[model samples]
Target: WLLFLGITLFQIPRIASQFKEENWHRISETIPVSEGTMLLTLDTQAEDPDFNEVSLKIEGTADSLVTLEKEFFSRGKTKAESLENAKVLGYQVSVLDSLVSFPPGFDYSAMDVFRDQKVNLILKVPYEKPFLMDRSLLDILRNTIYRNGYKSRDVREKNIWAFNEAGLVCLTCGSTTDETENQDPNEDQTEEEQINREKLDSLSRAKFRQRLDSIE
Candidate 1:
């Protein structure tokens, strides 16, 4: 009994050290984190094994998404205390509700290099104006959010959504709850095509349409 206790105590420190080391490595690969931004981790034990008991939540503006996505790519691969050292696990990208499946050979270093491309694409979306995404895209994004364990109401507040590797709902947009009360769902339907053509800046509209087409 004494030997077992001693061994368990020694293992505790080792395990804690390992967890911290892995976390630091994950953070290093995540670039362009806005100055003064905070990174938070939450662990909640659950009886179910399919879902992660712990989750990482980030709060930032749309522009910060680039950094967030890169961190996600990096951290998702690194061995976490909970993930059993699996190189790739389930993940969701909320911006487009896109399921970023980790192929057998996904490399975090390679993904870091492409971060700029994703950031550039995000820049194309004007934050100053209320941009309207197609319903289909919104649905996809919303679904991703749900898979991430966030509710639709919460995601509507942030106007973003997320998904996981198994295409599960993980998080939802957290926009103003009152939005649904003020706007009619059908209001945008009639104007979608016309607004796409007339209101948006020409180049921006083209870019948006191009992205929409690619997703389809």
Candidate 2:
């Protein structure tokens, strides 16, 4: 019994290290675009821990609704475990009356195999034409944009720029460099700045409240 326990403890670290290196796959597809404004939707049915990062590129003249560049990450003990779990998941893309939807599909009864697994997706779409998105995608982007310090009155006003030759552009809360540099050191902060600071503060407070509530 002592030897068995010792060998199990020795293999624990190796098993953990293998899971730490996540497995992923990438696929790109271009679908034909119908006339009028495009609608993008990301629908998921699994209750697993999934994170999606979606962005847009606005320079291109092609014959498609949008180009979907997708990368799927698997969080499992082994590559084969992740890949097999991912196979059970599904992605559906359809266009109806200028509305393009990407909804998640899978058999709910078969989701028992999804324990401790996650699916992280990175979707890139063309932004040359006008498009609308579902609330799920909007919420994800809103949290990311807000965390990056861009306080837009509406999500529609927010735009993702193309990556420049110098690499990724620095994200700001819609503050210009000149304005940041020209601010008077001794002058009081503006109301907008104060509000932004408060908003950030509230996020931490909200998390603390949740923890307290859980304990109660």
Candidate 3:
């Protein structure tokens, strides 16, 4: 009996180290607006390489101008202890007239255990009102936009949009009209373009040489 007890005690810490718990954290806010469009921006940044995923869902609702729901999952040694630790990492939502912003809630860089975490944001806005989104969020939802026969070069710095019965669309292209107008749609390359390309290549080589020199 004494030998068995000693073995069990030795295994207790090993078993406990593998224990994991998932915690859910959420925030909801309502913005008041009578008429006009609202702009929603999502700012997400994670320093930890283990930070796995961040998912966002935006839908239209007649009930509110802006509503945000965030879920956080945290894993640790015990369920109760994990949840208590997660509560320390809080987020904030801000509203200013017709604009709503969401910034990274917790300072994960300051804490070590908070490295393994995932955040999901769900935003609901008025259906009829027009809104603009930041490029960061748009990049995450790019799969939802249709891309058939569209080359990466064609849309690299251009605005992307979708049109259908639902009338969902991307607001504007990244490039300005003057920039687009200056380019020739013809297949033949211009002399000025050739010169500019060569200059860029030379600059790139110089930068590469500097990096290698620094390493040596």
Best by lDDT: 3
TM-score of every candidate: 0.26, 0.45, 0.50
Off by more than 4 A, model 3: 1-19, 32-34, 42-54, 109-112, 139-216
Q: Candidate 1 — worst ten consecutive residues by lDDT sum?
A: 116-125
Give the lDDT ranking, best first. 3, 2, 1
Candidate 2 TM-score over all chains jointly: 0.45
lDDT of 3 by residue, 40-159 (tens): 555555332234445566655656446667666666777776665555555555667866655634445434565256666666665434455555545334323232212223333334
Error of 1 at 158 (Å): 18
Model 1 Cα RMSD, 1 decimal: 15.2
103-184: candidate 2 lDDT, tens digit per residue: 4422224444433433333444332344554445553342332333333332332322211221122222133233322112
Model 1 lDDT per residue over 76-128, tens place: 22345323333233332222222221111122233322211111011111122
Clashing pairs in 3: 159-173
How high is the lDDT of residue 146 in model 3? 35
Candidate closest to the true structure, highest TM-score: 3
Q: List where candidate 1 sits over 4 angstroms from the true fold.
A: 22-68, 73-124, 127-179, 183-216
Superior by TM-score: candidate 1 or candidate 3: 3
Model 2 regions lying over 4 Å from their true place: 1-21, 41-65, 104-112, 134-136, 142-152, 156-216
